[model samples]
Target: MPVRHRWSAAAFCAFALLALAACGTLNTVSGIFGNQINFTAPQLQRYLNNSFPREFDKLGGLVSATLTNPKLTIPPGDNRLRLDFDVGVRAVGAGEVSRGRFALASSLRYDPATRGLHLQNPEIVSMEVPGSGSLIKGGTRELLNAVLAEYAREEPVYRIDSDLLARLPSGKRIGSTDIENGLVVVHLDR
Candidate 1:
């Protein structure tokens, strides 16, 4: 005897959409069906390197610092991305300088309008100054933190390609970004 199977209308519609979206062959099947996009460490590192060597001297030019050589890492189950960078501080007239290390972790989020993955709610895991316990004690640390906040909020760590996802289609957009398998995974939502 042979058995007959039935397919629901909703299921058929979903499958049809997936097939149509993936017909171009430009994007992977995972991207089309699973609605996921992955960005490797090297890709994110390159973006940081290009934006780095950033200087923040907006405080009446009294104190200034330059951040460079950003190292990015995903600590497996942390569900957050870690950023480590070198900081060189210089006083306006005194010319006195202090060097330090800044390590921060931030959660990720996606913005539909911009199609970019941005850092949200950044936390300072460690701030180290050689020969000193933690530079975070001084006001300079506060300034550094402010700069980091701006970087995280104002700048996007990575942007989803226009071609990969295609132009925005009304309610469809990237959503619920996370760090997994040493890569930033972006999911789509409608």
Candidate 2:
């Protein structure tokens, strides 16, 4: 079962964007944004922490993988968000197991219709099982990549059900979003 997330980057960004228009409506966003809002990496990290220790079964339930302790980073001057995860894998009934780290980086994209933020071009940066002293086997690597891709496509950092994106005043819409000084900064199209 997936736990509900109360702190939303979409909410944070959208609220800041909206608050920019109605300045007095939200006091918390007073200095957090203007033409662009900065979503700090720390905030995103905290939000993702609640959804962790996820388990996945692949290969006809022969393999079990658990992902935990997601460390999210917004590299300064980069648009892509880097995510690092500690992964544990076991081949049930075979007594084969391995533990490792998986890292990936992706840029954020928004869908106006769904009002969702999705990962775009999420690529695996590295997969290392330090104790094993070798990279994951080819089959396991493929499985991990497949799992990562599927998971990346299915989950978004934030999503809103409302048609809020369509209602931005004066045709304004979310534009280029990039990381600067370790913060995810969103610029609006004016």
Candidate 3:
């Protein structure tokens, strides 16, 4: 081989080795950083405000319901999320309609397998249906839970997208979730 070609080949090999070493160092450094993500209440509120209406509108069978003005709050003690919204419900064929405000409190669970935050054990905290009294309130609660269960089965309240998960080092996964000080803190671990 020519001297110039030999020198060029040697330099290319050295550059490749250096590039590989840098990549390895980056991975090592990222692993040591211990990634954790904090999702604030305002962010979650925006997501729910945007998604709840679209999801609720899809349940258009016996009862047609519309959710508007969704308000999210984190209650003290339990790490559950409280969602208050204005609901309008119309029953098909029965000619009965109700418009009122309702609140639902649900416990949050983190599913590592899917990298999503799921709402579980949702309970109707309060419901006001004019003229129908407690009977309609009870029925509304049951209907809401049923509908929410179906929705939750298919979609999580919040999912950590694959792109975000890819940023974490291999083997590092979401560990735990805590709701405090109006924030959802997600821990990541290997």
RMSD of 2: 12.1
RMSD of each: 10.1, 12.1, 10.4
Q: What is the lDDT of candidate 2?
A: 0.69
Rank list by TM-score:
1, 3, 2
**lDDT values of the candidates?**
0.74, 0.69, 0.71
lDDT of 2 by residue, 1-190 (tens): 2233445766688888886878643322212354665566665676678668888889888887788999988776776899999988888786547788888898877665545456677888888875553444555677778777766677665553344444445656677766666666667787
lDDT of 3 by residue, 18-97 (tens): 99999866522312245666675666766676676742533457776677788888876657788788887778786546
Question: What value of lDDT does candidate 3 attain over all alpha carbons?
Answer: 0.71
Which residue segments of model 2 deviate by more than 4 Å? 1-35, 112-116, 131-136, 159-171
Query: Which candidate gets the maximum lDDT versus the true structure?
Result: 1
Candidate 2 clashing pairs? none
Worst 10-residue lDDT window for candidate 1 reads 24-33
lDDT of 1 by residue, 93-115 (tens): 86646788888899788876666
TM-score of 1: 0.73
Any runs in candidate 1 off by more than 4 Å, and if so which? 1-33, 112-114, 131-137, 167-171
The 10-residue segment with the lowest total lDDT in model 2: 24-33
